[model samples]
Target: MTRGYIEGLLSSFPKLMIEGQQHTTVETDAVRYVYQPLFEDMYAVLITTKNSNIVQDMDTLQLVANAIPEICQFGSQDDIVENALQLLSVFDEIVSLGHRENIDMAKLKAIIAMDSHEEKIQDIIEKNKEKEAKLELKRKAKMFEMQRKNAAKAGITGAFPSTGGIGSMGDAFGSKNSSNFAEPEQSTYNNEYSPKPTTSAPATRGMQLGRKTKGAEMLTSLNDQVVHVSTDEHISVVVNRDGGLENMEIKGDLSLIISEDDKNATSIRIACLQDDSIQYKTHPNIDKNQFNESGILTLKNQTRTFPLNQPVGVLKWRFVGQSEDSIPLSINCWPSATGDGSCEVNIEYELNSVHMTLQNVIISIPVESGAQPVVGDIDGSYDFNRSTNTLDWQISVIDRNHKTGSMDFVINTENLNSFFPVSVGFDSSTSYCQVQVLEAISENQSVEFSSSSKITPDQYYVI
Candidate 1:
């Protein structure tokens, strides 16, 4: 057996090895010893039966000699002890059941270094999830801090009520969660406050104005004041840095809440500027044909009345704009690096809407961490938040009186891209499609109803 031959060769290995010899093959009465010097004093020896082929044993010994240096950093006794298990695995790979395996250095190394593509992808996904969770936590904390400050400013000493959920806080404050950027630190424009109607009409009945429900409890408390007509419009715009529209989307929804006494209200007539680019969809329960021909929202069955004391969505419209002119506001950002490790950023905004006035416009520009921006010239107020590392430029209102604004600031950063992909949030008093509710008709009589329209930015950014 090979075990007996190995034991005999180990006993006589000291006498057989020479000091400066590179390799040797010695034969005893029963076994043969084939070994080559590894380093100064280490030797990789192979013991075989006397009848075994010396040429093949020498070739195998050469392989063992080459692999030792690849496995161990230094061919010292300490390295050999530390990598004993790995060396054993390599030896087993080279010779299985006393028969040599046909493997080269490239294949051997590849086998040792096991890599999986799926594992790498999973790791990347886990990292992204972790990043999103952290961002959400930061947003919640910022919202709570802003709420606390606003409460203090309003002279409220009582403890704040528990927010129903994380999302409820943003909804209560008239802010939507942005996917690509952090939430604004300050309170956004009050979306609940409806603008005064431009034209005068007869006094409306059973209508409550400037009243917004905070949460589920608030809604339950103000049940009597829930009868109203409201329109919500969300605009999302994405633009490239140079000049082009990446994407532009406009969505509008009409909601109605009627009191029990006004259940007889047959149809709600709406007037809107006709546009071929707009697509309209009515609720399944409403008459789609009538809405397509004339903007009248009514049920299919004449006998059945509208739902009482419950909110119902009647009409929805969507518009996808391919041209840049469709954007209500256009923002241009220019960042240039100075000779010093700093950058000068100039941002300009222009109102493209002919009649609509934008309010509470906040443009958030990213900056380097722990870097302060020196504002040279700004049309409106500006604030640099160190915690979030962003410089926010705020304009109260942008109408015909003030349709353009600019901001210039300098920060200690050489990266021009750091100041890019600006996030914008604003409120508009008019809808993009100019859709307006004219009157509610019941039994061929004009019904007194109140209507309000509001526009909010869903996702507006420049990259």
Candidate 2:
């Protein structure tokens, strides 16, 4: 129909309807207008041809009237105008091509809700992926910053050293190997340089004869490209009340820490200064025959590879010294009680090794609770902590110049055994067992590598 005809028909609705009627119908020669009164002068209406089924039209109009209240609140003119598009959509679902559709209210409401469970799950997964990506970026940034700081502290300015194999001892002595692991020839130089003393004094701790080594620089520079060689020594020394060695035991191990990204399967050649007093043991997976004959550490199976990103203990050596002459540093403590409830303690440490230097030496002596030590003639600094009742003697560096030093302190205790069992801790750039890495052979070729050796007193005390 034209717009003017539809408007004229809508305008004629009031004149044709009775005042008390609940439903209204207007008939003309060609068509009929059927409508129901809504709230506040609004109506739900439908137009159809006069020849159409009046009963079905009336049913469709009743459905449309029922749906208008569900779609628009209050059924006011403003509410109907606000939900005009929604009402039209509902009307389309009710009637199709001028015919009523076979649909109920529950099915129509379900179609209008339009909810999907899978879409919500996909959105959550996408958000989580974005969060994980941000966390990974932060972790990498922190790692890079730490590496930069370590490189600067070690005075490493340029790029890392070339990953070329060592050619000669003289050429690659101090430049390539930043950690001062002795050369193969110099492995026995410690015994020749400083002989073991015959007196009841400590022997040489290790063979650190040169300047301090910067082993951290090599490890930091090579990062994941190089394997790490470490020697950890656990020493336990017990001295009697008369400053005599009661028992001494030393245990050490050589461990290899490989990186996950390093795929070069290598066999390490080593130069060991064999001592009759020490016993050696190899790992079960190692080739014992090859290690005994040529001092090469390799896997027993030729086809098997070393486990990546883990520390593997390849060799272990043990030494049991019953003499005080083998001790690196000797401590003598003498306590004299006064008539009062206090005593004066005299403690002295002598470094017997003339060739090696010890760093960060700390001697811990227990004192009575709430008692302050009056220190005198101390060679180094001392800190008295009353909470733990510990007097810590800190010696920064002990070399030839400051080898022999003494510390005297007075405390309120006549029991000398309270100050007994003084523990000592130190670090040296040397290993008790002078085993040096000669080279690392991979695929019948020498692979570039670095080595670090250190000696530390795990449990050295005098009781």
Candidate 3:
């Protein structure tokens, strides 16, 4: 009945219309007809019972007219089909279950947008907070810079040799720390270095360390070659016959400076990992109890004997494979900032299965001419401005197993070409893992090996 009445009224809408009228109503067959002009040739006809409000409904019709143009590019049926889903959503916001719900343009558009205003507001707030943190860090750095200039004028040498003031030092670095980022007392440094906050990312805003994900550069360098080697005393592994780990022996015997007791001494843990195969078998004595479910060998205290000063400490295990990689240490790098006449770099690394403490770890980064880099974020003991165009970083000792380290600093170079090779020269203390399987075991497997590492330049391109 309603549909029949609507069609009859719409058929005679042209005859009952008032001139120069945007909205009007007429009674036909004793049923009131309500409608308003949407376009020059199109109109929206609202069918209703006799009790429906007339004047108040014109307001609703006006809102519908206003909203249609914003949603439909052209006032035609084709435009409605092109944006059918959007049009339905907009229409639903104005009317629900064939009845009017809301007609206020502000609320209607907001509902149709489906955009979370709260989230957008939170993002703005976070950006402002990060900005303020960066500004505060700059302010402290400037204060230290001024003091260093004054000290230089007084002919002071080696005053505050390192950035000793306002330093972040603790086990909870990058884990937990003071958030307020309180100001520290003034101090002079021979260099322009500021101490990192003892807690979190307050100091390294706009610059971050660590890999969120691996890229082509990291993948290309992981195979066939990894760490750079400068000295002897590297670990060598031999795969026994029948595809079992036959022996793992340290080639060089050297004095180990152990800082902890016998119970807490560093011990190398070896896991057999292959690329093509997952179910590689191990020797019976291979510690399945400490074995990792991820198919990697677990080097534990009870499984095998890793003794100090025993240059040829052997472990009998083998698997059928031409290659095995136990990457002891891996570095991840990405460009953090492209500054005015500068480009900042952030570095992160993982020390995998490394059992012993690193006595002296020096990271060498090649720098170009007129490009000076200042290292920070991990007691950045560095010597730059070398004639060889290299930046030498002396980092602190890494003690904990599965340890990780990070640093953020900048090099003064334009955006054209900046990132260069970043390699570490740690005291190849005691032993480092080098895996290669041999079907026929022999003395020829014994070889002194070294690695040459580089960070590809594409990883640092900010654009």
* Top candidate by TM-score: 1
- TM-scores of the candidates are 0.52, 0.50, 0.27
1-463 per-residue lDDT for model 3 (tens digits):
4889567766776788776442356766666666644544566656555776643354455456557777875667787679888877876777676577734554565556543322332333244345545665667567766777788889986663445554542222221224535322222211112222123221212433673322223223222221112113333233321233333333221111111123112322333334342233333333455444533232333433222111112233222223322434455556555657676777665665466456566655555445567776755477762333456667667656437777777877654323433444454343333232211111223222222212111011011
Better of 1 and 2 by TM-score: 1
**Model 2: colliding residue pairs:** 202-327, 203-327
Model 1 alpha-carbon miss at residue 70, Å:
55
All candidates: CA RMSD in angstroms? 27.5, 37.6, 32.7
The candidate maximizing lDDT is: 1
Clashes of 2: 2
How well is each residue in 267-368 modelled by candidate 1, as lDDT tens digits? 888988688899888877778999889888887767655544334577889989888888989999999989898889999999887678888888988665
Tens-digit per-residue lDDT, 198-309, candidate 2:
2332121344666442332443523534566767666667666575787787788887655433443578888876878888888877789999999998877766566433
| TM-score of decoy 1 | 0.52
| Per-residue error (Å), model 2, residue 308 | 2.5
Worst 10 residues of 1 by lDDT: 186-195
lDDT of each: 0.69, 0.65, 0.44
